[model samples]
Target: MTAAGMRARGNVRTLVLAGALVTVTAALGMVGCTLFQSEQVSKGQKLYAHYCMHCHGEHGQQNEGYNWGQMPDPRPKDLSNKGEMSTFKDEEIFGTISRDMKDTTPEVGDKIGDDEFAVPTMPTFKYTLSEEEIWSIVAYVRTLHGMKLTYNVEARKKELQDQLQTAQQKADQAKQALEAADKKAEDEAEKKGVEVDEAATAKEQEANVAAIKELEAGKTAFANFTARPKLAAVPRPDLTMAETEAAKLAETGKRLYGNKYGCNACHRVGEAGGLVGPALDRAGFRLNGTWVYRWIKYPQSMKPETRMPNLGISDQDAKAITMYLATLRAPKPEKPIEKAAH
Candidate 1:
């Protein structure tokens, strides 16, 4: 064979081999991504089963206690319904699942505002799951409706940091302005030969210090958005037990109310408690059992601005307490003796 002919054949073979290697590498890369996504979705499924299945249902299509189409307003969404799920963006779904439903008063804003809805349909998962875990759930949710989702943690973290920085800057600016006002007031008091209200000044200083501390703490704590919740889960009581067991449950509930739950510290029950909270002496008659039960379990869920802390009362304990409270109806007023004269 000629030298040129041999050279041309060698070059063609080299080009073909190179092309084959490129194809194999690309295919392997795609397979690796698919495997990683499958793993993420699998982890998310487990989490959903544990945390979401109670209200969202076994397959995200049914609610536990209510009839599907006949339930009252603000019912759980059927997550397995493709037509309904398709309407939401991935970020929207993630935000709905993880973020607080109500708009808390921003540190920089003057006017108070709240969400337009009466009550949130779902509880916030922010206190429960890490950012990565929430993204996993989002991926799993896609599978429920036969879809796919990919999340960028770094990008979202950057966005959150940017927002926090802006709010912090505003807060710092407000603090400086407050300090300047305080200094000006002090100077005026000295110039006018008038005594400053030392108590008010001290209170103002304390408030300013608290605001600074909150800002500093927020930057460090919320940087990673993971939280260790103060309350622990307690077992729920069975409300449908036999009537013969009522006295035992009430006695246990009374003990919890006075000591373990510490209700008497803030609320009065037949004059044995403080005035920090309203008297619970007749709360059973004044309030409905269902409302009381929910309030004891999750106070801020019904009233967002409430100072009540979730004390992590067990479900069974709450039901027991409810039963005890229900027995405290006020005595009826006596009829007048004038009826005998009539």
Candidate 2:
């Protein structure tokens, strides 16, 4: 009950508090690391079946029925080649799934346009799946080969850069051809001794020069126009494999077509992505969910004559995708085109 007794009690309480803090820290760490390996493996299976299995077969050996094998000379690689699967790290595989060869959104002409916009080349699923889902796919891939394959991303990047250079070269050739044609026309005008409007001709020459310069700019974007446009995105947490999961899958599937899976890459759902394929703005007016699921799973199998490539989706992914496609209703009547100002 004196000063020394009070000081001794305070010291004991400090030690108790420190011990509890240490205990809590260790528990939190264990939870963070627990079963991480298996979780990653499960995620990989989902990604593989959804994105790789069609060509790789059920077990990832390899097959030809899927579009990957349907080439004039199908060369689907054997993923079991520990060397091949090991070639990519988790991050690299995720990068590949994010974009297509050219990173261009596919487009086909519209009913309203004199012609349709070009659809993106490869379907972009970047928006459909989360960063975690995508990253998990990479982690799962790492488990395959056992021998950790370091993805030579620098080399792949260089290859992409080379493709870009090749595209630029083609554009340069096109500009040269345009200039040659323009020169020929100007020469003809001079031949006729027509009093040329020097000012207008100068203006045209400058405009041509500017346009040729703009071709160097890789892709055009309307970033300034669509800032924070409230696009619908699929919320997770309800994705557990449960009864309500089916309804949630349908909601997620529809979101993918609109904002995630990049189905809008080719198929325009009226107000959705560019016209790379037939407008599905009203797919419901034409087909059913069974057909959509079957097509999403194996498009070429059903329509061997069609050019629509397989998305390499899994049963669950297909379900989610089909659910969204089912939402496609016929487009409203086309609006009247506005005339240009005189």
User: Which candidate gets the maximum TM-score versus the true structure?
Assistant: 1
lDDT tens digits by residue: candidate 2, 8-81? 99999999999999999999866754555457568767876665554444555655324333322223456557
Candidate 2 least-lDDT 10 residues: 220-229
What lDDT would each prediction earn against the true structure? 0.64, 0.52
Error of 1 at 50 (Å): 0.9
User: Against the true structure, what is each candidate's TM-score?
Assistant: 0.45, 0.32
Which ranges in model 2 have alpha carbons more than 4 Å from their true place?
1-31, 64-68, 71-76, 101-123, 147-342
- Judged by lDDT, which candidate is best? 1
Error of 1 at 208 (Å): 23
lDDT tens readout by residue for model 1, 10-115: 9999999999999999999899878878887898888877656544666778644222232223556789899999988888788776654342224521233353
- Range of the 10 consecutive residues with the lowest summed lDDT in candidate 1: 333-342
